[model samples]
Target: MQVSDYTIGIDFGSDSVRALIVDVTTGEEIATGVSYYPRWKKQQYCDAAANRFRQHPLDYTESMTDAVRQAVAEAPDGVADRVIALAVDTTGSTPVAVDESGTPLALLDRFSENPNAMFVLWKDHTAIGEAAEINAACRAAVTDYTKYEGGIYSSEWFWAKALHVMRDDDAVAKAAYSWVEHCDWIPFLLSGGAQVKNMKRSRCAAGHKALWHPEWGGLPPEEFLTGLDPVLAGMRDRLFDETYTSDEVAGNLTGEWADRLGLPAGIPISVGAFDAHMGAVGGEIEPFHLSKVMGTSTCDMLVVPAGHEGAGAQVKGICGQVDGSVIPGMMGMEAGQSAFGDVYAWFARLVAWPLENVLAKNTSLDEATRTKLIEETRSAIIPQLSEAAEALPISDDILALDWFNGRRTPDADQSLKGAIMGLNLGSDAPRVFRALVESTCYGARRIVERFIEEGIPVEGLIGLGGVAKKSPFIMQTMADVMDRPIRIARSEQTCALGAAMFAAVSAGKYSDVSAAMEKMGGGFDAEYQPDAKRAAVYEGLYQRYLRLGEAIEKETHEDRDDAAAPKPDKRSVAEPSESELL
Candidate 1:
């Protein structure tokens, strides 16, 4: 009898951490465990209204340890010892300020309870003003730092978030020596909590979000950063100059971490990356296929061979395209919407407002009864809305824009707001919900259109994450709206499996990512084919969506061209003296 080697994949999500144990030879998931962050679950250090969110380092350490230990313990006997490698994937651009000794400020005794010192989550939008400033400076420079970053800098990305937090809290700014992204920090922690200088940063995070590109050297020039803010000046030297992809090893797991998880010591740990990029590999992405990892937001990942049309092309209105970011030696292109399931969650909250605020005080129910009723109502809201909306007949008059979290693609603009144009007094929850669903699908369609317009043809789409697996109605609607077939990955944890594949490569189990993917890849579970009739109907509605969006864009802001063509050089086109921010 032959024993197979196993690898562990740890995925650090917004609310929880999940550990997956897999058989490297067969791609069989042997055991899995998940643990939600206790503090985050209680809504600590977050203000949704202000768009400020922070996560404590303890939450990450504790949840990851518990999840991994539980997963390894549940596997068959001796499987833990057979684990040869480990890898991690987490949310990107989620950077936290660190002290001189490479400890997160929030984890230090002096700043234990300070939210500003905690990890600034990717969804935080408090840095919008700072982002605009950076964009203005970049536009004025001889070389635009944002050329590869969708020609726009966003508040949700790295530099903007760090600058905002630094300016807001003097203590954090004074104490901080450098910043580190959550993805890079976790791997370093497992490798014995090394200093920032010794930490290996992720190419996926640095290239896509931090304006790190090969053409201008590693990071944006120090002079360019200084032009935006003196506070950001000289910080680049503290940060990394080079980055590594997931296919390489970050380091070996420390003895402490190995003993804590009951796994063998000194196993190779592959470099970390943003979850969606790794998930793309697990979805079996090809040259033209778009992989949509739809959850709260959606990250659409595309990869082409090194010299394909999109490889080094500076496509407008998408995320940065980085070489070797996803699969080694392939060019990785990313585009996404800032809101997907978030739109539904917003509507659900609106529906429950009356029950929570008004009904809870009703004399008809006691505290316990009221709490139970609210819980039940919350659970049933989305499903009930989905059913009622599906029952309603489709109409063009009921239309919406899925920009509740702001638009992230077809040009990155955070000032845009969501709108519903065809609401009447009779437009109840179900009718409006149906329109909202259509709106999200339309948003997705816009991204595909942008890709095609830019000469990057999307041959097909494969869906992963919670939204794809649980919501058949949404998947079918996406198919109809896009007029394309959508396939869902067989693995529920595609992101984790992708990390495992990278781990296998780092451990020398396979020659490369493609080779590992061939053996350990999880195939498609289901395919949703487009309905011709619905597709035709959606075509008309999509045009209406475009017109409404254009009108909204014109009415909402001054004349800063969103559709401007890329300038060959700064000298060729004159720079605007005024800021374009709304």
Candidate 2:
């Protein structure tokens, strides 16, 4: 009997960490486990009102250990012993300030409760001012550092977040020696790396978020960084000068982590990357095919073969075009909506407020019965809303903007807010919900259109993640709006599976990512074809969406300018009655 080699893929999402054990030869997911971050679950170190989202380092370390051990326990006997390697994928640009020893500042007792010391989450928009400054500085620089990053810098990225934290908290800045992305920090920790300088940075995170490009060397020059802010002086030297792709090995798992995870001590660990990049590979992304990871936010990934037509063009208003970011030898282009499923979730929460806030406080019912009723009602909200909305005919009477969390692509602007238009007494929850869903789909269409406008072709779309698997209404709506069929990947955990593919390559089980994907991929299980009538109606509604978006964007900027403009000072001008009469 032949024994198969197994690999573990760990995915650190915004709310939880999941571990997946896969059979290397067949891509069969042997077992899986998930552990939500206790601190994050309790809403610790996060301020939703201020858009300040953070995660403690302990949340990552503890949850990952629990998730991996759970997966190992669930797997067949001897599978843990047969595990050959491990790889990690995480939410990107989620960075933390670190000390000289390569430990997060939050892990130290002195800074234990400091939110500024914790990992700045990708969704945090507190750095909007900092991001604007970086954009202005980049434009003035001798070299356009943001050229590869679609000529726009976002608040949800490395430098902007780091600079925001640094300027906001003096203690964190004074003690911090360097900053590291969550993706890079995990592999270093598992490998027992001690020195900050020794950590192997990820190309995906660096190239896409840190403004790293081959043309200008590793990172933007120190002069450029310091010019943006004196606080960033000498930061380039403290941080990494080189980056490695996900297929490369970071290091062997140290005995400490091995024992914690119930795996072999010396198994190779692949270099880390952002979750969506690996997820695209797991979804079996092909050249020119857009892989849409539809979760809280949507990450749209497209790859073009090297030397292909328009491959080298600097597409404007995208996340970035990084070589080997997705596939080893392909050029990967990324664009995304800051709010996707999040938009639906926000509406659900809004409509369920009475059930949660008022009903929970009622003294009329027993505790258990009330709890059950509330939970059931809350859970059924989306499904029932979808059903009701599906029954209604498509109309332009109601429309919404999906910028509840601000836009992430087609030019990132976190200042933009969501809008609902054409609401009246007749406009109900289901109608509003349908418009919100359509807005998110229209946001996706804008990304697709941007790529096509820039000479990059989008042949089709491959959908993956939580929304793709569960929501038929949203998926069908997306198909109608896009006028394209979307093939949904079979694997529920594509991000984790993608990490396993990189692990296979790092462990020498496969020659490259493509080989691993071809051998181990779980192909699409369902496809959503467009409805011609609905599509035609949506085309007009989509045009309306564009016009609405343009008007809103202009008004948003005008409002911002009005707020920022200096007000007339009554004290500065003499009172006309007394002075002129005298």
Candidate 3:
């Protein structure tokens, strides 16, 4: 009967953080701000001789401070005081090593140079060797340990990264009181470290990244942890105590964080979670609806209804199958391509298509000129090449696996390599670029098909993220490729909107997540049906995608046999230094 007048959601991505203010009653976003992380970067290659990927912890906190201040400052009048709750969505597997008092160790001068002190990004491949060891252990154990996760471990997870840290740097490992994730730590810091028990952990993060499940007693059994590393088993109790959904109240804001963000202390802070899944919550697709957050990468979320004729057993190859990350009282399925918009961005860089220059040159053009020029160029590109990719009109041999980044689902393997099957002088930018787009769509199709085949039903696809907002060509191309109508989010920043919804739930403005989503989530919100002709055509193309994927994977595995990393890169690294987090 009551609605909170306002809420705030902060979305923390790999390189930036966005803060948004929304009115819960109307679901209108009042103001938002994005702050880029100054020291954040994927990887910088100084030369061909070495490879290093890292991001500074300071960069994340600084950006967080800036994003929050700007959003609160820009909010409508009376909006600040009635703001009842807050939430953050962050990339998973970005682990931080913290000391006994929960302070980040990276700030200390000694560990400043240590890559381990920095957040090990979701895509970091440094732990592949450790992942292999863990995977082998899981395969050997063959217990119920990997039940929800389909019996495999990944390099892009908590255990492998933690083991990598301990095995390489004993001092840092010994000093670490907790091997924490951004999803948990960010909320923890906001609630104040002194009141530990009231702090909540996201079930989404627990199920997907930390290997926590009710069947395995919510984290791999102690014996399993010990088998991976003696140090890992030591923190078992601290890791899995409490699990909260994206909307559940984790704790109230502490005075310190409240002062920093210029909000009243005790404004509710919901437990945080992964960006993609939260994006689904933002888009507000009820159970049986799927949401694809297209960004530098693509992550898919589907809500599995309460009863789906044994659907839980039917689902496969997802990052996680958990309850209530979206629509309350139901299972939320999470999966991803690990690269989508990044492919387009990569092509953008390659073509040196200066958006600025292109626009500048056409400044005097009419509105129709601007819209038509962009859309016409895009339209000509999408259908012509993405579908034509498999036929390989010019060079039949050119093949690629979307793993230029790493794998996220279906036996989550980061050790895997991307492959290009055939190359020749005939290949042009459109050809190569189209292949990139096609491969990613193929990856998404594989996930959707797996969900259906495994018995989980996906009625339709709801689109969100920057890609969904910026490019209709890609969304429609995906629709034709997957043969499902693509639904667009009403909110420009769907994840932020989703976060605000959770903020509503945490503030007790709604009964649960579903109630919050239905009431507050926005969108054009209509489904884009697939074209009959396009769907028929894509069926054959999808078959080729599957075959090409198999062949490329086979060849890459064969090569790895001879040129694998000598030792896991994690073993070669040292401890991250200690630092005081503001």
TM-scores, all candidates, are: 0.94, 0.98, 0.85
Q: Which numbered prediction scores highest in lDDT against the true structure? A: 2
Stretches of model 2 off by over 4 angstroms after superposition:
572-582
lDDT of 2 by residue, 256-319 (tens): 8888899999999999999999999999999999999999999999999998987899999999
Candidate 1 residue 59 Cα shift, in angstroms, is: 1.3
Better of 1 and 3 by TM-score: 1
| RMSD, one per candidate, in order | 6.7, 1.5, 9.2
The all-Cα superposition gives candidate 2 an RMSD in Å to the true structure of 1.5
Ranking by TM-score: 2, 1, 3
Q: How accurate locally, in lDDT, is each candidate?
A: 0.90, 0.95, 0.73
**Pairwise TM-score winner, candidates 1 and 2:** 2
